[model samples]
Target: MKKSTLLIAALMTFGTVKADEGMWTLYNLPQAVYRQMQSEGFLLPYRDLYESKDAIKNAVVNFSGYCSGVVVSPDGLVFTNHHCGFEAIRSHSTVEHDYMLNGFFAKTLADELPNKDMFVSFMREQKDVTPQLESLGYSRCGKDQQAAMVDSLQRALTDSVRQIDPTLHVDIDPFYEGNRHYATVYQDFTDLRLVFTVPKSMGKFGGETDNWMWPRQTCDFSVFRIYADPKTNGPAAYSKDNVPYHPQHWARPSLEGYQVGSFAMTMGYPGSTSRYISSYGIVERRDAENTPRAQVRGVKQEVMRRYMRASEAVRIKYDSKFAQSANYWKNSIGMNKCIDSIGIIQQKRDYEARLRQWQDSTGFLKGQLSFPLLEKLYARRQERVRTMMYWRETFRRTNEFSTRAMQLATGMEVKGPKKNAAKKYHSFADNSNEWDAALDREVLSVLLKNYREHVDARYLPKFYTTIDTRFEGDYTRFVDYLYTRSLLMKKGAKLYYNTKAYKADPGVRFGQDVMDVFYDLNEGMGAINDSIETQERYLCAAKLRMEADLPHYSDANFTMRLSYGQVKEFELGGKPSGYYTTPESIVEKMNRAAHITDYEAEPIMKELLSARDFGRYTDKTTGQMHLCFLTNNDITGGNSGSPMFNGKGELIGLAFDGNWDSLSSDINFDARLARCIGVDIRFVLFMMDKWGHAHRLLREMGL
Candidate 1:
């Protein structure tokens, strides 16, 4: 695409889209970005329940559940919605003490100190009494103008929160486009310890592999206790002597399950999503971009994950990559399943049918499109399918390798052009905290070789194919340069001594002449080549798409927006599947689907099944099993750990996933099909009492 065209596309996908539901405007968010975040549950808390403005001011939390917590006792016993403690729980677990897989319970306050890095954050107060916001004027401004007005409103609100509570952290979020912005305040508290967590078999249960899936059986819950100083009544570290926090409001943990249709609200921070997009945008992403890209990446991730699991060598070498890749792979699997789900297709059909009728009645989009023309465009693209995929995959893979190399090179150059760049090699020592110079040298060598081998040659189009850089004058010259360069030898080695040090070293004096000769030329050539390639490819794709009658839309960029819906189950695969599946479903699946682990070995599930008085959990509204509860709450990626609460302010469930039918819920909400799923609080309580055996935690809450 041309630079201008690419800029326009980015603006449309990232900067401009919004979610609109009939007369109810969700927010200006692109649909693709909206669905991605929505599926992840990032839109749950339209407004969170913070005690005061001081809390929001000191909160440094962003992206991954920074510091949101609950006050469980009159002494400020902070309670963070579980999941904020997942990693910490896992970290403290082992074969003997599998806090994650087997779960943990601190019988008393002293016992809770074992789980490290568990924390709770509190924002004490908030104040937003601004006359500027109260005053309204004619709304004739453009979207940007309106956005500016909202920004001003939010800043004022944040200022008020900070002024009222200087010690707390504050952030102002925009909601409903420019309609409203609230100053969210948080009290930052870090000293938290594990109070209890059900066994991993129950807590994580199905694990990431089954996360966000239905007919799903995972408890996905945990608990942490907060401690504070007796004298100050302020934040304190988790010392064995520290007293339990005295909180104002404590959530009554109940064994009461929610009904099928319950009135519940989610209180937490939601990330961001974009539900505002054109149909033209949707077709492009679903049909052209994400599906194919995800497929390729999915295969690679799966293969790497499998190898990592089986081979200790591969596991050690790629543990970091493995950790990073797991979520993406799991997400791809879920997204693919969701995209292919019957509900999503049906929803799309229903939307098209509605739009078709509207188009017929209103000339808003008549004759502007022709089905045959669109088909022709598809046919043209089909001819070059292989090339497109190859280029995309090559770019994706090489981009990763190239970024690492650039950072490494930059660091080396900054350290000075040493004989063999020894200073640069030491930086790796710092990064790994491994002072073994030998290992650092070996690893750096391996990394360079790996980058050269894995990174596609096409990525270096300027240097490899074109005779622009002397480093790539020919294959022989390339080989010789590698051998002679400091990258391949030791500081005292003869090969290193002869080679010119890295040019434009910025600090080093060694290779000034050599570096000066090639620095600008090399850098300028690379920039020009990349720019040309990007422009050419975009223009070519655009021309073809115009012929094909299809317009391409970029992938979903994370953005904040609202997605509206209600909680309800839909008929699929010939069964009335509720929006959530319980531990019961999990046990059944473990009996049927677990590849190797025995069903009986998972004590948490066993305990759940064996509970004598499983307790008559009731939502009072639907009166269903309530293994999982559904809500009309709008959510997306960032809302995962949010607490789903009843109107009377009881913890109901943890917002987890959306129904498959709601995959397109971002573009257009279909209340008939879309539903947000959560792990019922009843189940959480059951696990806590029966499996986690955290009675002390229960007693502390007066449950």
Candidate 2:
């Protein structure tokens, strides 16, 4: 067959263009893709999307480091997911003023709570840096060497940029499996304040039961304001003198709700996707990574759940921790199920086979990409990777004491001044306010036992010997002894600059033992990992050459991307799932809250939602308030707070989640099943007006 015919055959086998797929970067988006987007219903001009000074992309901000958000008012009032702001909410909550439970609304600027170390970043520009790297022989170097070069270059560029403007941040990221690179410059504002939030019962209404499921009504959004230097409206640290930032552009909120086929677009920083990974890599991820994560987190969460249910204090302390753990635990379980149900691994294998045939026929990268070598490398590293995941899940931050103790132990190895060491020790030691002793002790004991049962005897930490021999294999007894004898567990403990005393502490010894095992496991995998990385890069390059005609988008790397689709629905259990949900669904769920704890809500929530008048928030066509809607926009983790815009570039909603059927989308874009779930913008306004009485914020958004 001819090369074009062979490519077509490969495309047919891979099903590359199914539905509205791709998380495309706006800077270098193909004209073909742009035309397709316009055909689908995108009405914004190409220049207005990114190139113009008042572009829509200017309004989008990276929420802290893990999520996305959009500026909605000229005063820099931003909208993001409630769960994305979870840590900030948890930090400000005290027994006297539990913001997590009662909710918080700033009636004025002074009332907005300032958060420490919280910031939002705006991407100023992104330009291709591939030519510069290529001039330095980046393409000819090994993966490890290229990484080092990139690091050096990035630091140099950042330093130069800072010399010109101290507040700008720079990130040089590799794209297309390291075949290309882009430097993104950002201006980070460090004085973000909490503007508004709903109570836990409303913000997290559906909880885990409806976490990744469809037909949902979770109002998963929160509000904040970014403060800037009053002199120049540039980035600034938190201070009373700082004022709300005046952005060049802000998304206009629209009360006009969308229909089943209304155009939808989401622009945000998606965290990760491995769409170009090999079949062997997929198998390893499924068995080694996801399996251990799901299994171990399940055990840990159960312990936390029991303690949390018994004490409100414990619940407040562990709420954020549990949410983070449970979010990914459920995701891993769902991803594994989808991998099997959709035959993702076999599908990858089929695609690989076709690619190899095309390469052999055309002599395009025929000898460079070796599937057998990739397979062998993965096989060699699988067991060690599995053991490492188990080790990580068992010890890494499973409890507060061990985590702090490990930091202290690691600090002991630094050849620094005694004063510097003392400062580091005290910093690690002053975490008493973060965790409860009883709850952490219980968690450590359970995970200790769990770790030993799963890992090999040789892989056990040296502390396991202390437990096995001295404490007679009683994990609880051993844990109790460490807690009692270690000064690290004491609230007012001090180091006193005594290295001998620190080394002799039981908690420090336990920490050292854990680190030793981790170091050993990591060292053993270094060469195997190098080989696998090389093979994967070759595989990616080969695929690019074989299908050069296709509009290939790179895997997500927490960079800003735009995904366009429509407000569409999908089949669930062989039935047509509706495109949107209404307040009635939320009321129905609250009615069943007695049996299903996830559905529980505050009494006031029911009263407000049950009210007859939704005012202007009501959808004219349906004559009811729409809660959440579904779209087919490709998204992943960091897109949590992404703004969903209608064809006219008006903010319609904030994307918070993906449906359960699309859990495998990270590896395989099952366009038919993948759906982005977003909370309606009107619902956000309704809650603000009715529950929070936040008319100031509503008026600021021009609602």
Candidate 3:
């Protein structure tokens, strides 16, 4: 057989259900994959996973476009990860309530709290619309031309679709580098209400230290319900008269839990991945992109830790911010470690070598220069990429509060559209006030000095030089000068302030100067990226041509996808990595005060674990309560809260985190090491029944 044929077979089988590594889509489950599912113990009808009227498809939802959830009962009771709904939980909490500490369990429907601006969207339908998008035949067009064409066509299509139903949101997403397209019509339901949640001590056990790590014991699940307008049975803003929605399908939670070798399928939205990215892209990401991000976040997190430890109020205010930074900070560190350890760059090089060999033999491949152009473009833009990374890490990430100031100043600076401009400025300021000036100033001080020292002078925004000449490189004093009198820092000051007030302010002027430089630098970056994207699309077009018979699944883009795998064990360093974590294993690590940010194994919970209290929901074979389990389901960030179903399509677990070893999955999947960590559904039932004593909620689930 030819080497290309062998490569095609390997590609199909490598990151798949057989190897527990493919993030397969719901649009079409391949024939080979379907046969593999049946062989592995899947008992449901093949079409059930994708058919519009099926239980599975109707039950699952896209949670506010950020995470996934499943309806557990006909009354619209939804279940998702605690972190996915963390913002709502935090909003409802205060020093008086402290729901984050003790948790909430609505004993009755009346007790359920309505949340503002929270929503869940269900997929109405998805269809291939490639021909419609490609009819223009502008594959070779420049960025401007492509954008104009796409925008015009999209507007026309969306307008026509909206005429049928004004509420439906129909998005046409491109796949295979614009070679294919799919349109998914969505039904968005607002007026979601909080039903129940475990305490932070339990839901977020082990804290950031245990995030993305296995051998886990975190029951990261939250419950909510969708409320629909009584008359229309459609989404509406929160109202007292609203009634609970009864969805078409809901998942049946099983106490007949899974074990090692049990077939599992994960269905949810997964965020972005760059599996088809070039080796040049890989090198740039590993060294230039991720390196600075990790270092900068590490520093910022240290500053946040100090403030959080000093005051509980501060901790509550910055909890989400810290978690967002820490997530990728650790991932970047892990990616750096594993990319070298696992030789990912070398793997890409080897793959490229084969591509080159194949190209040499084919006239069409030999004639195209896009493949090598990708490498040269990335290399040439390395310095600009480095500076932008630093700017993003320092100014954009750490000094986010400063952006609010900038936004307010810019909004005030607008000359025309007086009434709307006033409303816009006020709204932006109102929303952007979710930051602590004290903490932001500290971050700004530390980051500015770090930024000046680390970033190259030539690539840096011109504001740095101004700060140097004016403040003599004392970044702290410069920050003090900016924050002390700047209207942006003056809380409760109405947005009606004069534009000249903003123009005269030092901080506002500084922000404007920085933005001006940023815009100039970005123009340069925009050109490079435009070229890269064009070349990348061409390369994608070429590869599909080259590997004509190969099976291809589009990269994840926070859209609904289905990944099939199994409950299996792994090993690291000659030690067996077990499938399920028992209660006894978690109790031994109980230390209330060892780590300030870490969750303590409380006495009540520690006792339960140590006593081995196997409730009715316990695994029958082991007679031990399973806290969490592991599966290789090719999931990413947005998969948090996705239902992990048994082969019988019964809810077995709630997918939450991916294993640390699989951090490189976005660019290159690791079949042997990649694993998805899930909270066992049995344990969730046990906790909901015994710990939370929310039997009323259980009864609604038909328990």
Give the number of the best model, judged by lDDT.
2
Candidate 3 lDDT tens digits, 1-703: 9987887676566435245656666767776677677877889887788885765878999998789999999889999998887878877887678677778988888899988778999887788876765678656566678668777776776787779876677777777776677788888998899999988888888788888788898989999999988887777788899999988889999889887888999999888888877788888998889999998999899999899778777777777788789988988888888888899989988987777777677755455545667788998888778777887787764675567555654554343356764443332335432566678889988988787778777656666776779888788878888877665656555434445654577666666766665676677677788788766666676677776665567788877888878887777667888889988767755653364446585577776667645767778878888999998788888999999999889899899998887788888888788889999998788778878899888888999
Ranking by TM-score: 2, 3, 1
Q: Which RMSD values do the candidates have, in order?
A: 11.7, 2.6, 2.9
By how many angstroms RMSD does model 2 differ from the true structure? 2.6
Q: Candidate 3 at 492: error in angstroms?
A: 3.7
Q: Stretches of candidate 1 above 4 Å error?
A: 1-84, 93-98, 107-163, 172-183, 227-248, 283-289, 311-406, 409-426, 429-567, 579-584, 593-604, 615-626
Per-model CA lDDT versus the true structure: 0.46, 0.89, 0.79
Total clashing pairs in model 1: 66
Candidate 2 ranges beyond 4 A from true positions: 1-16, 142-144, 159-164, 412-427, 495-500
Q: Compose the digit string of candidate 1's lDDT tens values, residues 1-703.
A: 8977865565355322332122122222234433433443344332233323222112212222432334444444444434556657655654455465456776766677444444455434333323354464414554456557667666665676668654455555443322334454555445667766765455545545555556555565656655666676556655666776665455554554444444455544454333433333345445554555555555455545555466444444443344344544455444545556534545554654555465456554345433334434444443234334433443333222222234443333234455645433312221221112232233323333332344344333333432236544444444334334433223432222213443422112212322332243244344433333233233333323332322222211222212333345666567776665544555566676447342333644655564434555544554434566566566555556556655344656676666554555544444455556677777766666666566666666677
RMSD, candidate 1, Å? 11.7
Q: Which of the predicted structures, 2 or 3, would earn the higher lDDT when compared with the native?
A: 2
TM-score of each: 0.60, 0.95, 0.93
Q: Tell me the TM-score of model 3.
A: 0.93
* Best model number under TM-score: 2
